[model samples]
Target: MSDTRATTQTVRYRERLWVPWWWTLPAAVLAALIALEVNQAVSALPNWVSFVVLFGVAGAVLSWFSKVELRVVARPGGGTELWIGGAHLPTSAIARTAEVPRTAKTAALGRQLDPAAYVVHRAWVGPMVLVVLDDPDDPTPYWLISTRHPDRVLAALQD
Candidate 1:
């Protein structure tokens, strides 16, 4: 999706990362089971009411999970921006961009990461892009962003 904010600026790259189907399917199933258990525990409610509640809860959970998305947008005039859930980061303050291997990503997310760095991680996404912040005003040292296409993100950042 393109955003027409100004004439000079153009959105170069856009990526939206959502929870995969594998995760959503299992989450839905678990929600349904939990709803069933709750209905059994509260038997005073009518059967139809219980059924409706179960479906409603399960649907709501599924919708919430499905709607969770990590959006990355690169604008030429402005900078690269990452939107994960509700968090947003502008890459203009970024000093460097590095493509991290899967193993490196795993390690970085664990005990190897800087305490002050910001991380936008998704376990399912293997490759990641590390953006180091240069802005003196910002306290965050870097950002670890999970991306399927690291090369594209890197190129956009470099541009």
Candidate 2:
């Protein structure tokens, strides 16, 4: 089953947070290094081939991370919905919403979180919104979503 909801309406709030330069830089460098190593293994390959491979790998990695978007849309009829990448959750199903502190965020991502909880986390982002699921049918206990504006996300979830 797909995680996204099919909807055709204007979004109430949209937050797109790209992977920080720090994260991208390392990924690019690593990709380039790997490409170089591959080129050395295959001496017949031209230098330009390695460069193209490096940029292609790096660009694909960067593009995937950079395209991550968090959206909170108010459905036309009545409910609020949260979207992280391709996953979507209706606010009605959220039992609770809170703005998690940095320490709590770390703990949640580390030892504290339940194995059943869903996490949409980005290492570069600090503040996050924690949404506890109320739907009994769903096995997920909660969702940990990284966001630059945690308060805004919390408000949207509550609305």
Candidate 3:
């Protein structure tokens, strides 16, 4: 038997671009129509209902700006990796891989010490697995990663 592993290519860095609010035009229209029809009923509904509706609207607006944009490139057999937005980092400096959960808190890479970060498509999108690095000489010590395919991305990086 022969070991036949495919040639390893550099994992391209991709910039996760935020989907503009305009992208939700259809959603807004739908909401508006529903709201118009439900306006009368809204008053009859419990106060909690209004709260939920408000949260829904706010969540939608936030989602519009939190979409992930990524930049990926061939690994080039070295530590250098460029983000889709043109940011670069060295894989050699990677401190560890932190598995992020899929939730609102995980969106936009929440504050440090936060185990999970939020992205635009928190529930719809795959959970992010951040590559924490030690930036001994810099203030930034971690990378916000929202790879399209987390398991595959992790596998490629491990290789």
Candidate 4:
């Protein structure tokens, strides 16, 4: 006997918010400077000990800056979900959506911003998408998600 099952699932948009390549050089330079200071201050420890600090600092910067990821996934069961970091929301729950340009970002994140809104903002990512939610049970009125390609993200959700 043979059994066959077929399923269709697709990832519409995916963006990993990693620290830019240029940032690595600056982080390494800063780490080296700190290690030099540590070496000067501590004469009893071996010179190699300062190298440990240098590596640690560089690793920490890279780790922290590369964490958040944005994705839109289409389910085989039928529906779209938006994922940002650890949180996920169905696109059906979104009432309206808008792309906030770099110039308007400050205003979007400023005084008018709601405290209960879900925000996955990154300073390094210039543009973001504002998702206004219609779910009554969820107190979150909106979600501000940082993305490198705001238009693509919006298109995925719409489809």
Candidate 5:
């Protein structure tokens, strides 16, 4: 006999939109080059100072470029939430959701896009999900979110 019960997992889906690993190579190299220039221009400063600047600039650049994350969570008590970057919305707020194929992305984001819509987009990630809001109190018409796996995102939200 099958034991029927609600899923115990709290996180339905999670993805980090990180910059490519090769990205760090160029960023670090540039930072190092800049630091070398600074060192040459200021010969009085300690050699270690240039290293510090290199690490600081590269760390900050990498961190800043790779922070967007999407997560779907099932609340401990009840309810579900979709988190895009830093913002979040309850699944109950979503009236409907649709996939925006790569071909139609330009149209969706162009003339048809609403000024008040909540959008978290990444250039590297193709395909997206449109979440139409039903909440009367909310002024935003909908949310356009970029996802590497739109199907997984849709499935997570549906569940």
Candidate 6:
């Protein structure tokens, strides 16, 4: 018998994308209007109260959707890693792998909005796989991961 031991069990890639305030202008405008109405009900509140409340809500919304990080790793022994956020999933916990296309508006606007310009443009561009993990406690059963440069992350996971 041979002796083999594993060191790291998981490897994840996490990144936060930056969203410009202007991208959220429409939502901000609506939030500001609603805040004004609420502020009027609280007449004792200062004039800056509405602005603070409006911005607070806007900031919260922006913060929630500002960034996306993708984590890809190898499973222990012969398993896959977990990927959350967007679709909430795991590599080995899935059966089917598909290419998800970006909506026209999202694509057009995203070109300008994507600071990293890592948008998935072509159908063949995605070698993304869906994993099906065996962990019952695990939440997601499937994860979408890029096939391009899979080794870069795969090697990282092995290390």
Among these predictions, the greatest TM-score belongs to 4
- Residue-by-residue lDDT tens digits, candidate 6, 28-145: 7887888788788888888677878788888887776644445554556766554433443444444444433333334443453334222322232333332334556655443334
TM-score to native of every candidate shown: 0.74, 0.82, 0.47, 0.89, 0.85, 0.45
Order the numbered candidates by lDDT, best leading. 4, 5, 2, 1, 3, 6
lDDT score at residue 114, model 6, on the 0-100 scale: 35
lDDT of each residue in 114-136, candidate 4, tens digit only: 99999988888999999999999
Q: Worst lDDT window (10 residues) for model 5?
A: 1-10
Give me the runs in candidate 6 sitting further than 4 Å from their true place: 1-21, 66-69, 74-80, 85-96, 103-159
Write down the worst ten-residue block by lDDT for model 2.
Answer: 1-10
lDDT (C-alpha, whole model) for all candidates: 0.72, 0.82, 0.54, 0.88, 0.86, 0.49
Clash number for each model: 0, 0, 28, 0, 0, 13
lDDT of 1 by residue, 1-159 (tens): 333553445555556665666765676677677767877888886656755676677667656654545555655655667656677678777778899989787688889899998887767778988888888988888888888888987876666
lDDT of 2: 0.82
Top candidate, metric lDDT: 4
Candidate 5: stretches off by over 4 Å? 1-9
Give the runs in model 3 whose Cα sits over 4 Å from its true position. Answer: 1-68, 75-77, 80-84, 103-126
Report how far off residue 81 is in candidate 3 (Å).
1.1
**Which regions in candidate 1 have their CA more than 4 angstroms from the true location?**
1-9, 62-91
Residue-wise C-alpha lDDT for candidate 2, range 11-114, written one tens digit per residue: 77788878776766787788788888988899998877887878787878777877889988877678878989889999889888888877788777888889
- Indicate the residue-level lDDT of 107 in model 6: 41
Candidate 3 vs. true structure, TM-score: 0.47
Ordered by TM-score, highest first, the candidates read: 4, 5, 2, 1, 3, 6
Checking candidate 2 for backbone clashes, the offending pairs are: none
